[model samples]
Target: MEIVEFGSDDSGLVARFVDVSNAVRRHDAPWQHLQTVHAATGMLRHGWDGEPAVPFLATHGGDDVAAGEWHVGNYDNLHIAWLTVDVHPAFRRRGHGTELLEALVDRTRSAGRTSVGGDGWDNELSRSFAARHGFEQKAVEVNRRQLLAEVDPALVDRLHAEAAAVAASYELVRCPARTPDDQLPVMAEMVSAINDAPIDDLDIEDEVFNAERVRAYEEAHAGRGITLHRLVARHRETGELAGQTVIGVDRERPHLGNQHDTSVVRAHRGHRLGLLLKTGMLQWLREVEPQIEEIDTWNAESNNFMIDVNEMLGYRIVGRALAFQKSLA
Candidate 1:
């Protein structure tokens, strides 16, 4: 068995990595959309918030059998490294997964990270794998996809109206594909509201956000051929940013959309901003992106508030994922 590190520039190896990943996805989670080489290439080159994970591909007897990655945040959670190991379905039970995991753990420790974390679909196979590695389940996250075609237009109108009535003191602002130069400051501050979301027992720190990070996020998404639509709620009198929701539609797969974030500032709670932001986004997408068939989102099972709003918006569970962590110490 041999393991080799790769970057986005290595087109040949990256293609092999995508093949292994798509195979794993098809076997483990067929409900997921298959990955495209173009999207995978962009992700490897420009990761979330501009911090790309280090990728490794493993081969045995000249056949690629598995892939792995190790990622750490540049702004926060400096002591932990998030890792992933995916063995081709046909290659499972051959010790490829264990070999790849051991290599990734070594890299994590070499990076001075004291803890490593990863997530997989909540299934007996995944659970047993984590348990065998001495990793503990830290949290469970539900993947929900809202089918736009199944949504009732009247129900959306009614919900939007009801939320608008409660949030009468605020107005929605439609941001462009890229946030304007002036709003980046407050937008950075507003993005931090996501920290309030529950993490369960995960040992991680609140992500640090700033104007630069916001720009990086937008750039990263753009690089992946994703069109971003952001809607922000502002106080009518004080002109402050009260809350916001962001959704991204892939230009390559225009029929599918993704829910990025929907957060309400702490002081602006109880005004139904979460509902307003999400419902308003749906209405806007109908006008601008009428071809979108579904929008996918993930939320911690412990996040009842967000879950309630998602349920009200017609989002249904597709699957649940289990997060697992182990201390290298």
Candidate 2:
């Protein structure tokens, strides 16, 4: 077996890594959206958007069969090293995955981190691998898919009507792929609402959002051939943003859209803003990107509120992911 660390902007190596990664995704969850080489390259180029990442390649029997990206950041739980690994289906049971994971753990320990964390599809192999390696289940995430073709037109109308009736004191604002300058600060602050989501025992911290970080995301999404559509409910009289939601459609995968984030400020709760924001965004997609066939979202299993909203919007569980962590100390 051979292990090589990828260098910056190495498109060829990144493409190969993506090939192996996507192969794993296809075998594990065919219903999931496929990632393009462009998107993979963008992630490699940014090193997970500048959080310090080291990607590893594993070759067994002289062929690349597995890959892993290990990351750490001061912004997150600094003592934990975040890891993501993908092993081609054909390479499973050959000890390639185990060897590569050991290398990742060794590197994490050398970096002075107290723990290593990762997420994987909640399958027999995934669960057994984590358990064998002494990693404990930290959280579970549901992968929900909404088929746009299955969406009922009448339901759409009803949701829009119901949201409008309750949101009489607020107005909905829609924006294209980029954030406007004036709303940058509010948009940045509004993103913090995601911190309220339950993470269970995962060693994670609330993310810091600011104008620069939001701009970085915009640039990354644009580079990855993804277009972001945003909707925000604004207070009618004060013009303050009461809630916001975003949907992203990748040009490379036109049939798949991603439900990014939807959050209603604490003070704005109970106005059905979550529903109003989501339904309004869905309506916008219906008009502008009618070709989108399905949208996928991940929610913590314990987040009943968002889960209920997704269920009402016709999303159903297609798969699951489990977060696992191992103590290095």
Candidate number of the best TM-score? 1
What are the per-residue Cα lDDT tens digits for candidate 1 across 145-186? 999989998899899999999999999999987887788999
Question: How much RMSD separates candidate 1 from the native structure?
Answer: 0.9
Candidate 2: tens digits of C-alpha lDDT, residues 197-282: 89988877788888777777787777767788888889999988888888888887787898888888888888888888888888
Clash list (residue pairs), candidate 2: none
Quickly count the clashes in candidate 2. Answer: 0
TM-score of each: 0.98, 0.93
Task: Give the 10-residue window scoring lowest on summed lDDT in candidate 2.
Answer: 43-52
**Clash pairs detected, candidate 1:** none
* Candidate 1: segments with Cα more than 4 A from true spot: none
Cand. 1 TM to true fold? 0.98
